[model samples]
Target: MSVTDKDRDILTRTLWGEARGEGLAGQIAVGWTIRNRVDDGKANSWWGESYAGVCQRPYQFSCWNKSDPNYAYLSGAKPIPPREFAQAQIAADQVMAGMVQDPTRGATHYYATSMPKPPVWVKGAKETLRLGHHIFFSDVP
Candidate 1:
């Protein structure tokens, strides 16, 4: 799949919002999860038809949710630290260019392990990877 400048920008912001504290490897894992979502044949239409679509899709990536703590930064109402934004951009470029293999191993879903309760959807899904604070899953039915 080819990534447009818009797609790269959206993905970079998403990495900044979702995985900024998790460092480069964490950002890459998050990027692959988004790519996996874009590639999932069975995802609901609201899940998105493109990178921007998915990342901005309501109620999907919580960082875009109005109530989410990261919304202000993600929505451009606040600035992301220059260093963090630069790191996220690097992660986005690598993934969009396929310069590094997917570290999530086809995972389309993930949640921070720090969440007190795992989402109900994880029940029957296969756990595919754990990097930083996130746990990734696939083969959901």
Candidate 2:
């Protein structure tokens, strides 16, 4: 489907409770915002491996996690600390918050790029929440 159609579908799903309030569209918007920030090739704009590459596409940066070892490896550094991860989360949250009407139900996750393990809180909310590898958010109020 076209990008416009995909966005419409995502919005519909969110409104109808078929998807979370911070669903695919929110992710896409966040990613797009990050891409714009890093597209200038500024050294400090590097967030992770997924975002290290040029953002020719819009949603490429949304799934990136600076906390991941892979990102660190790519950037020639050790894994990011909790503070850095929190900063990244805040940045992502800021981007997503502007695109989405609701912020209470919006959440983002940062994962270890090289590790195979999932996020720590996945099991707890799996039954009631729509979970993804790097992020979790709810549609219910």
Query: When superposed on Cα atoms, how far off is each prediction in RMSD?
Result: 1.7, 15.1
* Global CA lDDT computed for model 2: 0.35
Quote the positional error of residue 70 for candidate 2 in Å.
5.4
Candidate 1 ranges with C-alpha deviation above 4 Å = 41-46
Give a tens-digit lDDT track for model 2, residues 46-123. 432223232222333322245433444223365434443444444444443454342223332223233477645555
Candidate 2: where are CA atoms >4 Å away?
1-26, 29-99, 102-104, 108-118, 126-141
> Worst ten-residue run, lDDT, model 2?
11-20
On lDDT, the candidate that comes out on top is 1
Backbone clashes under 3 angstroms, per model: 0, 1
Displacement of residue 5 (Cα, Å) in model 1 is 2.2
Q: Please state the error at residue 137 of candidate 2 in Å.
A: 4.2
Residue pairs in collision within model 2: 68-113
